[model samples]
Target: MRITTLAKNYFFYCVLILTLFGQNGFVYSQCPTVTNTAQSFCDTQSPTIASLQAVDNGGGIKWYATATSNTQLTNSTVLINGEDYFVDDNTGNCGPRQSVTVTIYSAPTGANFQGVCVTSLSQATPSNPQFVINGNNLQWYTTPNGGTALSPTAILTDNTIYYISQTNPDTGCQTSRLSVFVNVGLVPTPLGSAVQEFCNIPGSPPTVGDLVASGNNNWYLTSAFGIPLDLSTPLVNGQFYYATTVDPPCESSIRLEVLVNLYEPNDAGSNGNRSICVNEIATTIPFDLFNLLGGTPDNTGVWSGPILTTNGFQGTLDVSTMTLLGSPYVFTYTVSSALCANDTSTVTITILGLPTATVSVSPTPSCSGSPATFTFTGTPNATVTYNINGGANQTITLNGTGTATLTGTYTANTTVNIVSVAS
Candidate 1:
């Protein structure tokens, strides 16, 4: 809101004080006195006769655009910006006519200049200026009313304010210089936490933001979350380098955090190295088994050992060797990741505990003539067998989840024995 002005000094009409009081109202050879005055207004507005001080002190008043023009201004008049006008009295003894200068001021306003500091002068000049001069003839200066002209939007690496001037060309009036505080703040210092990777090229000096001190950025290796790493700190797998911005002393909020991106390899369980039950895979194994340890994902598996079969995480388990290998069976496979060369995971097979077998008979009493139903409960995916009075053994596969049932016709219920075997 700072303003510079060119103002006209005020003058008291000395002639009016003397002649109006005199007893002899003489139309003598006294000069109709005129006071030299200054005129100023914005280019958007017009000037008036009273504003220009165009009235005579001798009591005879008439305003004209020119010294000799007949177009008399009986009332108010709108004078052009920065244009001139003359006023005189022809009815009374008058003196030399006086000329008034019209001054059209250029309103050079400094708008809110909030911007990021740039590295170069060219970068400082924005597409749109922060300050605006209302007039067409606009000029920019480094110093107040000094130096060569510059663009209004220019930004400097250092924090400083630039001066600007606006001119009213129509009235030939130039306003005093106004200022636009070009708050050229260096892009908030890039802190180490802002980076995702770190090549650790010391002295080569990677650019980073200094969140602690403004306009100064430092490079540093950081922890997984971006905290600066200690000097000579050993880089860890799947870690990160951070880059953050320093807060300016005046502006506390100018801050930023970014990742440098480059720390590779995941930690311990990153590969597929977890255990799975052998019996759980009736038709296909769980897909997440590949990432049991941690992985690069998109991996494949090769079944080996007594099963001697090839498969994937979702492939069927080897039930044939369940009897020999028994429950809690162990197996291994190498699951690799993508992109990077060294991404292998761990996936193992574990046969779960076998469920016991239980038999339930419907129509328990001697059936007389109807067929009796024998229901067997066992581990999912296991085989169930039953003997009816030692007549013969009937085998049926468990529902792979629940119970298995068997039906036989007998005049009287002799005996029902059931057995369950799990792989």
Candidate 2:
């Protein structure tokens, strides 16, 4: 029984020693190993509590603002810049905890850009940075995160979203939270000008052409005041046309204006014909070309005839000196419209010569002694017929004296009838 009691006591003392040694082993182990390093973050970034925990990472962690403190850090605690944090792995109050530095910096900020245009993507470049946020270092990039670096003097040539960062010149750190959007503007290129013609006829519809703009460019028409015109279909004539170029995703546009002229097509008046007497041209009646041919007051015409007929723009023509006592004569009067290439309408004037007739009898009623003479007067060398004593008609031709004489004997109460006709 004495040996059994001594063995049991020895075993209890050994277990007690082992338990005390085990508990103090980690507590006194070389001031809790810690290898914390400095970290930087954006002011807008929400850091997790785990971020505040030391890399030493063992046992219950405690954080403090000073080297020694009774207050502990909750998981919901927020971290800030220029703040010193102390960490400890021990479960109770202790000294010598790991330390981590926290830094908070601001991201770059700027407004959107516009009116940058280019033909290709390779030529794209960002304009000078307009940083709304100020920092130690300024830098631009092609993307929101990481991409090609852009120079401060880079010329923006196309539509793009460029990223910029503001480093805390003190810390040499930057963030890519801010961006500036640039747009490509339309090119102000004129399609050129041309003339279009339509006759005075009807059934003319609105006109439009696709040559105004190239592929992928939408074409639109507008008035001088920049009022939008119909684009679902064709365009109209006689209207001042202005071609406005529009490109998508671009807040700006360019204009190419073209002029359109509408005029009345030339359709000369119908050919005119009229009769006139010799030396009887002057008339009170005035000829109005506008009322005569339904043309504008600006119509012009030329009269070509004998005696150097007057050729003037006047509507009425004086045919007095243009005609003479002769056979049918032709006087051409050509008139042109304002819109015609030349005058294609002509007016003809015809004149007739005067005819004369006369009758005379000599040695009146001499009974069978001598043949009574009957005379007929008419145009030179004209033919005249006279009937005597109701007998068969006798015909005679006027000689150079413009008179025709017929000889006949009176049988009983002589009766004669004389008439003249032009040859």
Candidate 3:
């Protein structure tokens, strides 16, 4: 009975030993529990096998490329996408190890681009080139690897290679960089003077063809991008036009600003003729010579006629300083300009002299308050005016003999005077 009991206790002890240590007589610990069984990483991260181990617990760890492989892999060994990796404790007695699947994200695709150098004043910048990519959250960089992302408004170098990258919005995993070549074309030379001036004639106005330029010129109404204009388009005064050169498929991005100015020709109006009595010359007010002009004349023209005073665009005639009466004076008005020929007109002013008159009293020694006769001699069939005792005036007409008489009732100490003798 004692031997049987000792045998049963030994058999139970062996079973317990077998359960504590492994079948190979080595102590056993739990295999590492991979917190993340399925892992995803960007190719740019360069994940490795050691990245799969989650728990250490001071037991150390080992990585294998396959699930059923005895060969161990170093921490420096790179990981592949869609492949399973096995991880276990360094004890080497665990029954089964944890497995992990790695997923590597590739770089986004991008296409090459072309650009042009746009020049303005003394500065130049790239224009008309765009970077196209296939993924979300795209970014541009100067180097192929890690670097600061470029700004959207950053200027690109000509004929250079730029790197681009994209990121997954859900996973936040960024892909590797892709190269894009930018081929920038050369800028073409400009044509002619910026501003031009031409005369605006009545029958023929200035046109776009009249502009002075030399090249394969393409004219535009606006300074920026716009449709080209025809050569027959009429040029407005003080308007601006743009010009560019067409060098095959590549045109100049910088446009030459051409300002057009149409100048109106100077005008001197038609001739004028007038006559005025010398006695009435003092009463004649100063007048502008422009009123005598027949057609519409430009006010900027200078007046050159007799001795005239000018006030800005107007000329005043001075009729007070006239030595000769009953004579015709011709005043020539000329308008001159630098761009147009001179124009001239004439104004003939004639002054008339006062008529001569001789007065005689008839029926001498007449009584007071009696009718008296006054005789006047003047030009043939001329009219004369006389006043008695400073009373109201009376008129008298001369016949063919150039003589006339006026009768009036006079008061005591009456006086007779001829007011005017005119024909």
**Candidate maximizing TM-score:** 3
lDDT of 3 by residue, 1-423 (tens): 999999999999999888766644433444566788888788877888756647764456888766668888988889888999888667644657778888777777756664444442122222133344575677778899888987766666767887777775636877898787765444465678887988788888888877766556778888779998888888999899888766444567778888987777767788887777788888888777767777876667666655666674466787887645536777666777766667777677788777767777767755777777778888777778887778799878788899987776666777777788767
Winner of 2 and 3 under TM-score: 3
C-alpha RMSD of each candidate structure in angstroms: 20.6, 13.0, 16.2
What order do you get sorting by lDDT, best first? 3, 2, 1
Which consecutive 10 residues in model 3 have the weakest lDDT in total? 120-129
Better of 1 and 3 by TM-score: 3
**Model 1, span 1-423: residue lDDT tens:** 123222221123445566565624454333344465556665444446656654445556666677677677655677666566766675522544566777667557656454543433465663345334454577766777557776555445445666656766545555667766665544543433333444433333233321233344433453223444443444443533443333342221323444333333322234233333454446543343434444344445443344444355433444544532554444445333342233333345554665567777787654466777878777776676666777577777778676888786656546777644644
Please provide TM-scores, in order, for all candidate models, with all chains considered together.
0.31, 0.40, 0.41
Give the count of colliding residue pairs in each prediction.
52, 0, 0
Error of 3 at 61 (Å): 5.6
Whole-model Cα lDDT of every candidate shown, in order: 0.51, 0.57, 0.72
Please give the lDDT score for candidate 3. 0.72
> Candidate 3, clashing residue pairs?
none
- For model 1, give the 10-residue run with minimal summed lDDT: 1-10
Q: Candidate 2, after superposition: displacement of residue 217 in Å? A: 11
lDDT tens per residue, model 2, 1-423: 999999999999999999999877756553444565576676545654556635443465667776777677776788877787777765635456767788777675556554444443334444333234455477777777767667756766455676667775444556655676666554444355544443332455335553344434343455334455544444445654655444554312544556555455444556556665453455524342223333443345565554344326444554555545543444444655544444455455566565566777787875655578777777877677667766687677888878867677766677777644555
Q: Which segments of candidate 2 are over 4 A away from where they belong?
A: 1-138, 141-153, 159-170, 173-183, 187-227, 231-245, 249-268, 275-311, 315-344, 349-423
User: Which of 1 and 2 is ahead in TM-score?
Assistant: 2
